[model samples]
Target chain A: MKRIAYPAAIQALIGELKRLPGIGPRSAERIALWMLQSRDARPLEVSRVIREVQESIHACPRCGFFTTDTLCEICADTTRDAAQICVVEQPTDILPLERTGVFLGRYHALGGRISPLDHVGPEELRIDALIERIKAEAPSEIILALGSDVEGEATANYLATLLRELPVTVTRLAQGLPAGGGLEQADELTLSRALAGRTAVKG
Target chain B: MKRIAYPAAIQALIGELKRLPGIGPRSAERIALWMLQSRDARPLEVSRVIREVQESIHACPRCGFFTTDTLCEICADTTRDAAQICVVEQPTDILPLERTGVFLGRYHALGGRISPLDHVGPEELRIDALIERIKAEAPSEIILALGSDVEGEATANYLATLLRELPVTVTRLAQGLPAGGGLEQADELTLSRALAGRTAVKG
Candidate 1:
């Protein structure tokens, strides 16, 4: 327990901060102290936002990305090509590609890839939804925007086999970019490599 | 504004985090996301804590440090000697000396030092309360456990002058620690410098 009153709240804030990829307990406390520096924090107006998000935000029903609405903006846009679904793991990964304004299509957010040892497998993902979506929309192509890692490759291979009989083209993202980095952290050249190296599959 | 529900609340969280001594916008967003990751963060819980702190946690009526009641733990502890009031800038600064278990006395948090550039002067600080505390407690020694900076020196000098007529010793924490270096970050050798170089106040 904190020797102070806001200790729990501060600790909670730190706990939340630690969930981020690089942050730790010390960094989290530093952040909480920083937030508490201003006078307006007395309103808990800052803390309320944290609690409100815990109370309201949820995954986009269609894309699995955090969104307040039922569907993400990308999924809701009717002008975009619904026949091409660019699949990715996290929402932050969508920004860089979106900045390029190159691909115009919808998206499918697989919660994560196949890593049974890590307890993340096909069941934990939205694979069934993708299949259902493919059967319903009959997208011309299903872009595998997963990382070029063991899990990514396993997921892509499984999906290709599952969608073999479908009319839609099943393809992996291009290679030569990197083998293990997430789409969010990949450089433009690497992303371009994966994008360019994309090859058609027998399935 | 966050393009999400309760934009004000989200903005408030971001603003509050930014107000913290060192957080940036990206970190603020991550903290917000972490809170949103769970539902135990009720609005009542968030708001109540803030209100409770605003109402309950106040400057110890005597020492100017945080206290749940009128008097802080240091001031209330009957076993401690009342003749020595260790003056510090913030409540957190008192911890380092406490860890050493070297001092057995009360404390006075000045809240801040004399900094003309930021317009933080004697009036803006708890210097008056410290003076009042000195008069009331009549400590034999007043240790200025403050930062090793111009502001600290100025404040210490000013306090020494104010207490010149009083039959008490006003000693500073020390000086060779170097300007702008915090006690928290300084090595053991540097800290010893501040302690060893301490001398009698001219005033």
Candidate 2:
């Protein structure tokens, strides 16, 4: 069936919007049209924000976390524990961990994990920068707060092997059943890991 | 929980992105970060398209469809029938009907339907423009292709009553089970409508 042809500019905007995650063709079309039809200057405002963010935001010099300034906020804060550093796969991972409020140390985002299938290796990530930070800061512990996925495991293992002779101790996140998770819903592997990683309860 | 503070520009962008439909806080953060971290000039490209679409697209003077030119593509086409106009509640509704390839008539987008709950009346819609077009063109028939919702039904009935004194005939989209829809899964109302509107089977 022949489709109703939108203007070239509208079509282009829709196509670009569809490139974003979770945006489909219908969603892109709706957003584009809504922007165009907005009574206020919403389209111009959105454009300005996108351009400004792109021009200003970049990876922190010390850590891989995003920042407009030369260094990220965490890196610039002297009050945070310098002796401890938590390493994560990407900058997005830092937020959830921060929400937990369990760790008081600073963070080092690895940009991404080492994925062999995707042709991404240690060189592609911020592994070198992480090593340099360890050497310079001499952190007492490096907590690898990575996903339980294969790539995350591989990256943590690679870092552990690389830092075997280093002064700092390396550890990974514990593997077990999730908080409030039902035993019936827990997969066999997760149940087994939970059993193996059980800790002694206080009397 | 102490959150890692993103740069002001990045945070502003994320805030603006969260205003879009279906986008939550996490999705906004991911999209904002993705745009900033994009190796290519994707952010710039997206910005350029948004600006272009905003500047160029406007409502069609005749049919209220979005167009860069004075007339939309459908209105500009000579092959389509001008004497039969299909009316819809919004410009977005036009596309799906076009895909059916069933009708080859011109369109009249009412912009919105009459909704007393939302304080929307016939005057708030493009009803006047529709009446003017009908008077000028004296179309043989007008088809109201609106949603099956309450507001849609109200608008259709109101339009039917308004056009009763006019010269042209009026009709609406058929009510029944959708094409390729299974009888077993069909809702009671839909099944009843299908039965009531059933046509004679030819040998």
Query: Top model by lDDT, which number?
Result: 2
* Candidate 2 lDDT, A9-108, residue by residue in tens: 9889999999997788988988887896677887788899999988877878887787878888888878788988999988878778777877888899
Error of 1 at B70 (Å): 3.6
The prediction achieving the highest DockQ against the true structure is 2
Colliding residue pairs in candidate 1: A34-B20, A34-B21, A35-B20, A174-A194, A174-A198, B83-B139
Cα misplacement distance, residue A193 of candidate 2 (Å): 4.3
What TM-score do all the candidates reach, one by one?
Answer: 0.77, 0.88
Q: Provide the lowest-lDDT 10-residue window in model 1 chain B.
A: B1-10
User: Which 10 successive residues of model 2 chain B have the least lDDT summed?
Assistant: B1-10
- Residue-level lDDT tens digits of model 1 in B55-131: 55565677665556666667667888888889888765765667767788878888788999989988988887877
Off by over 4 Å in 1: A1-21, A35-37, A177-203, B1-19, B25-56, B177-203
TM value for model 1:
0.77
Report clash pairs, candidate 2: none
For model 2, the stretches where C-alpha displacement exceeds 4 angstroms are: A1-3, A182-184, A188-203, B1-3, B182-203
| Candidate 2: Cα lDDT at A134 | 93
Model 1, residue B44: distance off in Å is 11
